[model samples]
Target: MRIELVQLENIRSHVKSTVPFTRGFNCLVGGLGCGKSSVLYAIDFALFGDPLGRSYNYLLREDAETGKVTVQFSQNGKSYTISRGLKRRGKGISQDFDQLKLLEGEKLVASVKSEAVAEQLKAITGLDKDVFREIVWVRQERLKELLDAKPRERQKRLDELFGLSDYEKAWSNLAGYQREYEGEKRAYEKDPDVIGMEKLNMEYNQTAEEFSRLEIELQGIAKKLEEARKTLEEADLKLKELEEIRNLTEELKRKEAQLQVNLTNIEDASAGLAGKIEEKKNLIENFKQRLSTAENRLNPTRLGSRK
Candidate 1:
């Protein structure tokens, strides 16, 4: 799938920038440290979720990450808009996935991810993180190095042309089958007259019975193999889902801890505020008492102040 366009805001080296890329030969013409590569990584991360980092700060620009990065782009004629934020207050990143509708020629081709507004983009795209990186996109410099390689230096190039190294496997099975058939034919030739013919008939009937029994066993084995594969797949999915749930639970605990810290801060702030308020109230009362004292002193016992 080809990504046709991308729009990034608040990403590294881009405070608020909207850049439209072409479907072919789009070069980010800029000097070093101007965030040329950052744009590429951001585009890959937004469209495919193949970010080059294990953490939130891995691919993002320096001194950033307090704010969010909004990315809008189109892939394989379908458009997508995603807004992601790794706020300073939280341990996990907040993600939003949006499916876009666009007209392809005269018909409207809707994006398939419209069903879930909030999910891992992997769920929306039906692509795992590794597959997206391998099939859809590649880094610019790595592409150049891969192209300049010799045939012998690369390991997998030869395997693609020729089949697997265990190429005699099917041939070996066929040879064994031929040997068994020849032995059966020679055994039939070793018999003689009408009595021998009767014996041969008995042997044929017995072989047919054994063949039918083996066929049933093979069928059962095949069914069990299919079930085994399905069970393996289910187990893998369950493991991944459990991992995600664990991560989410950890995040929830972090949020709860932060909330408790905030409550404590509010309590301390409230106590300080109360003390300041009472101090100001006492100051006003003192001012009034002093004024009354001065007036009595001026009148020489009008209000009975101490002489």
Candidate 2:
């Protein structure tokens, strides 16, 4: 929707001027006396039901003058017209002090009923003020206000702009899951490997069995190693004793060889001496035999003297 012309009668400084507008980037530039911004306010009134949520006549050209505004615009490729008239008597009283007329194409489909007719006019125009503000309503002053806003106010504005409500819901769900995970962690942190309370007693039985097996194996190995070490020490002692016996046996064999040689030499010399003695005895026996023979011959001589 786009507005082309806005006629303000006794509305602010517009007086009776039909302020022309453009479809895009429209600027109403003039000196301070000219109603440049007042023209913008006139368009604002036609769409906003009331310009500033107050009486439309408050922005009229003069206090005593009757206030009326007419806006011509294009909606959905069709030309439309909306008109509002304001009364000055009731300043803040609730009464039918305003009127609205809407014309669609070449027909007046929206009829005027109650005088305070901004709502009825909107129903005919199908124009949402919020949508209009988004596209066309802006000011440098408003930009400054937003930029200079407080941190909390800016946060609210940013939330409204980016629609962060869904993130809040997701965070709540994540928090719920985190709480559940923490609960599960706490439950099983120190839990035994046993399956159930009834089966838990089997843990002690199995552990005791394993402990007995390990103890038996360890004792066997210890005994084997101790026996091996003791055998090694005993073998070392026996080897030393055998070495001493071998040395003594070798010495005794050498002494026996020397004693046997001495005994053989003594036997040879003594046998020679004994043989010489026997020969001397034989010679004495031969001399005795010769002397006996001579005596026998001499006995015959005594008888043979006279021969």
Candidate 3:
């Protein structure tokens, strides 16, 4: 893998910087405090995010709200671009917001947040942060530390560099499994059941008897469960019928109340009608008495006029 371009914004001392590299031999030649190391750190930030041992806040520029790093690299003839960003949480505080994206040409392939982004970057590059820092981009100080390491530590580092760590881990796991197997074998040999076939047969008969008794008990329990289920179903059905009866009773009561109201209204109307009929009868009797008096007076007047 070769880095083609690195872009940094508000990262360390770099406000905005772009560094490009050629195909073969490329070196960053600059004086002290000229951001040469910051460029490399920015590349590391783009690939693997913040270093595990160091605080992420140190990567941010002073008084900057956000920082970003973008790296374009070529691996196996395919070009990939990775971008990462961080936002400050408060004044003089580390950024809480971290995001990363992996793109092939113009198409986005992976977008991850925080720690997952580092994992995805490792998967894409086939090198973790520590391995990349130690083997691919070893600083002068780190190289000195490597030289000064003990023999065992040096061998461990060599194993990591050559990808032999996985094999060492596999061998270690195999030894552990072998020890476990041996221990199990010893335990089996000491077991009383391993003494003779007669003892084994007796134990087998006892286990079979116990299993048979348990099976019988399980069958009884199954029957009880079925019976309980049927009883529950019956109870549910009865509850439904009771609910239906309760609804019908409420309907009947409402209808009875309406019928009582209608009866009261009819009785009131009948009483008023009877009182009007009695008044009409009294008026008719008074008119009949006035007519009889008028006829008697007229008959007397006619007889006097004839004389």
Report every candidate's CA lDDT: 0.62, 0.71, 0.83
Q: Candidate 2 on 266-285: residue-level lDDT in tens?
A: 88878887788778778777
Report the Cα lDDT for residue 139, model 3.
81
Candidate 3 at 5: error in angstroms? 0.3
**TM-score of every model versus the real structure:** 0.37, 0.45, 0.50
Candidate 1: list runs displaced more than 4 Å: 61-77, 90-128, 140-307
Q: For candidate 3, lDDT tens digit of each residue in 1-307?
A: 8899999898888899989998999988988988898888778777876643566677888778888889999887889998988787655544333357888778877776656666655676788777888888888888899999999999988886776888888999999999999999898778777666668889999999999999999999999999999999999999999999999999999999999999899999988998898898888888888988999999999999999
The Cα RMSD of model 2 versus the native structure comes to 32.6
Which segments of candidate 2 are over 4 A away from where they belong?
A: 53-57, 90-98, 111-127, 131-135, 150-152, 158-307
What local lDDT score does residue 49 receive in model 1, on the 0 to 100 scale? 44
Best by lDDT: 3
Q: Summarize candidate 1's per-residue lDDT along 183-272 as a digit string, tens digits.
A: 988876775665588888899999999999999999999999999999999999999999999999999999999999999999999999
Q: What's model 2's overall lDDT?
A: 0.71
